[model samples]
Target: MNYCVVGTNNMTASQGFYNALFAQAGLQTVLPSERMTYWIGDDFAFATAEPFDKKPATHGNGTMVGFSVGSKEEVKKLHGLALRLGGRCEGAPHQRGPKFSAYVRDLDDNKLCFSD
Candidate 1:
């Protein structure tokens, strides 16, 4: 089955924060126009929309969204960029097994895992 995950937020500020995040991760943001933005990857896409009838979710509790890259260097670079873009490092870049990885939380407190 094919599936795509999209997050809903109450403000354009939240969506804009994600835009910068996906950019730092080297993913392209695809939007129908200017009202919504999506990060398209080889196997999945994450989109965000402004909340119309619902409020944004409270932060924390360990939900995560992960992405894989080509190398350990890329993982480190993306993690560093994420920090510079205002994301908090959930964990520093390191080898978890044979592969290197790291985690960070975006401005909205969504966890993102980067691995190689």
Candidate 2:
């Protein structure tokens, strides 16, 4: 997919969370507006936005965004960093099938996975 977006009720908190997370992950911010913020990497893009319908943004029950961060070490690093940045752990880093992965829920409770 070209990109994926998660909904956030609090834009300021979401932006702060993602800005620090993406900065360490090497994703660059582009095309930011008051309601939406995007981070782009070489092959993919991720974004967070306030709902366009003017209702409160809520996390989808089964939806998640995953990032392939290249190595188990990086996955672990990001998992730890995310916790330090206020994300909650869904799962700790470990090998799952052929990939090493970890899971976290952002400040808005949006799920994310980091895999290697």
RMSD of 2: 1.1
Q: Give each prediction's root-mean-square deviation over alpha carbons.
A: 3.0, 1.1
lDDT of 1 by residue, 20-103 (tens): 656656677777645456777667677665444456655547677777777999899889888987789999999998879999
The TM-score of predicted model 2 comes to 0.95
Worst 10 contiguous positions by lDDT, candidate 1: 1-10
Predicted structure 1: lDDT? 0.71
For 1-116, candidate 2 gives per-residue lDDT tens digits of 98999999988898888888877667888756789989988888899999999899888899999999899999999999899999999999999999999999999999999999
Best by TM-score: 2
Q: Where does candidate 1 stray beyond 4 Å?
A: 1-11, 24-28, 32-35
What is the number of residue pairs that collide in model 2? 0
lDDT top scorer: 2
Q: Which stretches of candidate 2 lie over 4 Å from their true place?
A: none
Q: Evaluate residue 2 in candidate 2 and report its C-alpha lDDT on the 0 to 100 scale.
A: 86
